[model samples]
Target: MKFDLDDQQRDFASSIDAALGAADLPAAVRAWADGDTGPGRKVWSTLADLGVTALNVAEEHDGIGASPVDLVVALERLGYWCVPGPVTESVAVSPILLSSDERSAALAAGELVATVSASAQPRAVNADFAGLILVSDGQEVREGSAGEAHDSVDPSRKLFDVTATGDGWAADVALASEFGALAVAAQLVGAGQALLDASVEYAKQRTQFGRVIGSYQAIKHKLADVHIALELARPLVYGAALSLADRTPDTARDVSAAKVAAADAGLLAARSALQTHGAIGFTQEHDLGLLLLRVQALRSAWGTPTAHRRRLLEAL
Candidate 1:
């Protein structure tokens, strides 16, 4: 069977790339880390204007009602730009978890931000910035509140202890978790690509022993491996998206497989990127640090690589 994004999906991806490309993403990310959300909110508003925030929400909720494939496409680009916040929570999981709520309209309009703690996960990311907080214990969902902030490897990803505050309702927590994993997998692919691209560019310019580093066989092989891993992970992500859209019986297994592949590939890219950039990559001033830190944090978010690998093993 043919597997590829259609023309409209490609165009939508391009528009998001262009819109985010014009934004001062580094500055926005920095401001977000310092507890200022203005710049980041503006970037999210831009995405909302492009209908990104509405992709998964149903039409009855004033959302675009796009497919899971479309959501993967949009989120991959968002990851490439390293847009900070509870991205998977707000854009992907919340729509399905709150499918019947009117607040989805506000989310579609970029008027509201949300964070979720599901499957007994104790902390919710970016809870302070979220107007809506959701907690699920695998069978039921309830509104929640942020209690205290916690430090993260990526400062831009603020974590909070959540406390349930209101009434509860039944929800498909398993499906919600799957969506979150799928979203994170897509973002991992995008972030890996970004890291690989930066490493490749850096390799072309930086020289050692009177030759450009790109000319070195070791550097070339390192980058080539990262490219191959990312390329392989992309299809699995898309495949998982398709499976979820079709509601296949294998959707959970596929999503876990995708998550494992993406986390491994993204971490490889991060390591290779830091190696390519040498010591400079570790410094706060370098932009590579941003992607590096993000990849680390995301590798464990929603689910850890080890956890997904175990899930895949269990499926087999």
Candidate 2:
């Protein structure tokens, strides 16, 4: 089945892209890594003004009541920019998990930052900065506290070990897990795209043997392969989003497949981009490190590659 984004969706994505492009995200990511959230908050404010913070919220709850597709679109842009925050939790997972909770409105307005992790998958992203941390065990939700900061492979990500303090509510943890996986998959696709774009741009400028590296068959083939892989993975992500929107019986399987494909593709892009950039890519001074580390951390964010592969096989 064709799952192309409609014109409106494309336009909305373009708008987000434009806004993010102007936000100086690389500097913000640097500041986030240094424990200074001021610049990052400014960027978040930019997204909030764009209605991104409210995408998944219901209209009755003072949200735009956006679809899963819209949420994915916003997240893809977030990933492309490597925006540092609890985006997957706040933008994708929270509204679904806390639909009736009073905090939804504050979340939708970007006033409240929250983080969520499942008991089955217990790692909270940006927990130190989030106003709330929640853990679900497939049946019940619980308020949680960040125990200790765990440094993520991605310098921009501030992960935490969380433990439930008490019960919070009853919610569909299964659906939340699927949605979280799908959203991370979308982010992976966007990060992969960024890596590809950066590699292509670098190839045109870097010279080897007095010729543009992009002219070499090796660089050409590597970038082309990564581009193709990411292109293929993107559809899986969009398809999973549609499955969630329709409440399909295959949502879990599709979301797992999407996550696996997108993670693999994002990793491939990171490796290819690094190889193409050579010594420069390995340095902390270069922005390529940010995307590479992010792709590494996200590869196992919602669920590990092994877990997703196993789930896909079982579904088959």
Backbone clash pairs for candidate 1 read none
Give the lowest summed-lDDT range of ten residues in model 2. 112-121
| lDDT (tens digit, per residue) of candidate 2 on 96-193 | 78858988899889888889978546888899888988888768888888888888888778778988887578887888888889889999999999
**What residue pairs are clashing in model 2?**
none
Candidate 2: residue 46 Cα off by (Å)? 1.3
lDDT of 1 by residue, 52-75 (tens): 898888898889999899999999
Per-residue error at 143 for model 2, in Å? 1.4
TM-score of each: 0.98, 0.97
Off by over 4 Å in 2: none
